[model samples]
Target: MTIQQSYKITPIANLLGRSGSSHLLLGLLTVAPTGTLAISDLTGSIALDLQHAKPHVGKDAAWFCPGMIVLIDGVYEEDHNATTSGLGQTGGIGGTIGGKFIGFSIGGPPCERRNVTVGVSDGVKSENGDVTAGAGFGWVDFLGVGSERATGSKLRRTEQRLLGPDGAHTGTAKMVVCGEVNLDSPSTLEALHKMLRSYATDDADRMPMTVVLMGNFVTHAVMAGGNSGSGGSIEYKEYFNALASVLTEYPALLRRTTLVLVPGDKDPWASAFSAGASAVVPKKGVPDIFTSRVKRAFAEANREAGVKKSGVEGEAVFATNPARISLFGPAHEIVLFRDDISSRLRRTAIRFATLSHDLEQGEPVEADATMMSGGLGTDSSTRENTMDVDTPTPAPAAFPSAESADFETLMARKLVRTVLDQSHLSPFPLSTRPVHWDYASALQLYPLPTTLVLADAEAPAFAVTYEGCHVMNPGRLVREGRGNQIGWLEYDVVSKRGVVKEDML
Candidate 1:
C-alpha cells in the first residue's frame, strides 16, 4: 500500500467469544468479489446492508495496531482490497451467522480522520505499546544493557516499560541456537555429535543452559512422503536412536542443559503437520517420544551402554516454529522463529530501480512502478493479493560508496522494518500466507520480547535492536547443503547481560 492511498477508519469493538446453540441474531460480515464489504444481520433487525469502508489507515492493510479497538459500523470485513457500497450478508453457521464485531465509523469527528504512512512522524498510536511490560524481571536489559526507553514509539502494540522488576537479574548461562539441521544425513549427525562433545571437552562450568536445534530433522524424502512405510519408520527410528545414544554419552550436558527442538516446514509431529497446511504453528512440541517405541529403544540402548538416563527425560523439549523462552519471570524473554520471512519480505516488497543517471550523479533512487487500487462493477470485496512488478529492477551502473552502501543495505533492513512496523510476523495476504486462524495471536508482536531470533536460510547473518527488542537472524545451519552457520548468545543469569555471536559450523 502507498502513502497516497492511505485512509482512516476507526474501530469500535471486537468479537468477544463463540456463539451458543440458541436462536441468536448475528451480524455477518462477508467480503465479496468486487472488493467491497457487506454487513447483514441474521435476525432481520436490519436489512441486508453493504458499504465501501476500509478500516485500515495506511495503504497497507496490516498497519492496524492492537489498541486500535473499534467495531465496525456494520461488520468487519477481512480483505486485501475488497469493498462495497452497502454490506453483503452471509448465512449463519449452526444458527449463528455473526457472533460479534468491533464497530468502526469514518463519519466520526474531524480529528479522528487521519492518514498514516509507514515511517511517517504522524500516525495512529497502538494502546498496547511495550511500556509497563518492561517493568518485569528481565525487561530491563531486554534491549541489551544501557538502552533508553522508546518514547512516542511508532509501533503501539509494543510492551511499555522502562524499568526492570524490583529484584536482581537471574540470567541463564548461555544458549546455542542453531538453524535447520537435517538429521537425515549421517555426516550432519556426526557433525552435531562432535559439536556437543566439544562443548563437554571445553569446560565443565561453561555449560550452555540450552541448545536450541531448529529442524528439518529428516531427509527430503521423509518430509515429502512422510514416515508411513516400513522403511520410512525405520529411518526415523534409527535417526532418533543415534540422537538418544549421543545424549547418553553426554550425561553432564543432558542433566544441566535443556535441548529445545523447534520444527520447520517439513518437521514431523507438529500441529501444522497434522493440519496438513503450512500455517504458522502454535507453541508446542514434537509427538511424545516417551509413549512411542522410540522411548523403549532409547532405554534399551542406554541399558546396553551401561548409562543411566534418568534426568534426560525432561531435557529434550519440542517448541513451536515461533516460540518464546522466558527466563527469570519475564526478566529476560527470548523469541525464536524459524521461517523464510526474509525471502518472503524481499520478494513481496515494492521493487525499485536505481537509475543509471542518479547513480552517476549521486541521487536517491526512486520507485516508478505504478500502484494499482481497484477496478470492477458494484464494489464488492475481493481477495487482495500481494502486488509484484513484472518489470524487473535495472542493475545499478555505479560502484560502491558510503551513500550507496546505505541504499544497498536498505533491502535487508526493509524486511525487519516491515515486520516490526506492522506488528505482524507475516503481513502478506491471508490467501497466499497460511496462519492458524485460532492461533493467530502467535504472530502478534504485542509486548515485544527481550530478544527475537529469526532463523532463516538466507545469507549474511545480522542483528538489530528495535523498540528495545533485540532482533537477530542467525542465518542457517545448512543453506542448500552448502555449509553450516550456528549462533550462540552468552547470557549472564545474574547481571542480565548477554552478547550474540554467529559462527560458521
Candidate 2:
C-alpha cells in the first residue's frame, strides 16, 4: 500500500496564547528496494535525508526508517537590555536570522546508524540585541539505544521466555472509580454510598472497575482552648475507629478491588505544628498517623479473609493466590504488582519459520569450492541465536536519614500543599465551605470507593510504604463549628472513576 500526505505548517510566535500554532513532525518509511527519501523544508528552515543500502553479497542490507523527527529554528531577541522606555520595558525584541536547520531521529531498527545535525549562522541584531550561533552533530546506532525501546534479542529472547506458557485466568479486568465526599457530613456519606452502589451493580465487561480517590476527604478541625498538645483527643480516636468499623463491614463488596488515596489541604494535619521534641513537626504528620490506623483496620479485615500478613509496607499486596493489588497514595507513590494486569492480558505469541524449496531440475543442493568468488564463498549459512535469558539486579537500600532529609522532605511537603491548593482553587464551586480539622475532631464517612480521607489529630496514624516513599494520610472528618454542619462535597466522575487511557493525556 502507498500513502502520501502533506499539510500546511504554522509556527507559534507566542507560547501563552490558545491560537499559538505549533507543529510536530513525524514520518515513517519502508522501502522494499534500496532507495533514498529526502524532505527539504520548503520554508528553507529544515531538511531531512534518509537512505537505505543495497544488499551486501548474500546478507541483508541495512534499512533506514524513522518513527518521528522534529526540527525548530527561529530568531529571538530579548528587549529588556535596551535603554528605550517603550517596547524594551515590555520585553520586546527585533532580529533577522539567516538559515537554521535542526533534526532528530527516533525508532529505527537494528543494523542502522542515524545522525542528526543542527546548523545556525548569519544574524543581524538591533543596538541592544544579544545573539549566539550554534551547530551540533549526533550519531546513534539503532542496535543499542536507550531504555525506552527493546532490542530484537531482548524482546524475542528475554521477554518471550519470561512470558513462557499461558495460564488459566489470563484474561484481566480493570476498573477506576473516583469521587469526592464530605467527611464532616452524614448526607455526603449517603451520596458516596449511592455512587458505590451504582459501581457495584455495573456490568464488569463494559466498565471494569479500579478505584482511585483524589483530593480532600475531610475538613481539618481548628484547635480551641486547652486541647492544643501533640496528643489528639479520645473522641478523634473513637471517630476514626468507628469509620474503620463501617468500612470493614463492606469487605466482601471490595473483593478484587484496588484503592488509592490522595489527601487534601482541608485535612487538619497538613499544617505545621510543634512536636514536643526540639524540632518542628508538620501538621500532615498527624493525618499520616490516622491513615496508618485505618490501614491497620484494613489489614485486620484482610487477615479475616485468611491472609497471614498485611502487605502494608508497599503500595501492593499479594494474596494467598499471589494475586496483586497496587495502591498509589498522595505525592504520587505508586504500588503495583510485579506483573502488570494489562500487560499480562495483552501478551502475544511470536514465532519464526524458515522456508526452503528444492532448486529447479538438477541444481546441486551443496555448493562447491568453484562457487567461491572475490573472497565471498557460498555455503549453507547457519544462524545461531540465543534464547530467553534474565539478569536480575539487586534492589537499592533506603536512605538511612530520609526521615530527617531536609531538601527532599521539604520539596515533597511543598508539592502536596501546591496540589491541594490548586484543586481548591479550581473553578468548580463547592457545595459547602471547607472546615478546619483539629485534634479531637470526628469525621463522618463518605461512602465513595476511593474517597480521599484526611485527619487533623497531629499524631494520627501514618505509614510510609518504603523509606523515601510518601506518607499516607488516613481519612478523617473535621469538626465544624460544633453543630456538625458538613462542608462542601463536589462529585467528579474523573476522580470517582480511576484515570482512563484518554484521561491520562
Per-residue alpha-carbon lDDT of model 2 for 23-138, expressed as tens digits? 33222221112232322222212222211111111211111111112122112223334454433222312211111112222111111000101111113222345233233221
Please tell me which predicted candidate would have the highest TM-score against the true structure.
1
Task: Summarize candidate 1's per-residue lDDT along 1-505 as a digit string, tens digits.
Answer: 1112323322112221221211111233333344333333333212212122332221222222112111234343332232331221233322222333322221111111111211222222334431122122322333233212332232222222322233122222567766666676665666567667656643545667688887656544343354423134456556666666666667656655677777766555442243323444554555564224434434444455443533333246667767878654434557788776665544443322322235576865453211122211112232122111101111121112223335324333434434554455755555546677787777766545556777765534555443344566655454345466445444443333344564455
**Candidate 1 residue runs with Cα over 4 Å from true position:** 1-172, 201-203, 219-223, 226-231, 269-277, 289-314, 350-412, 479-505
lDDT of 2: 0.26
Per lDDT, the best of the predicted structures is 1
- Every candidate's lDDT: 0.44, 0.26
**TM-score list, all predictions:** 0.54, 0.30
Task: Give lDDT for model 1.
Answer: 0.44
Report how far residue 111 has shifted in candidate 1, in Å: 22
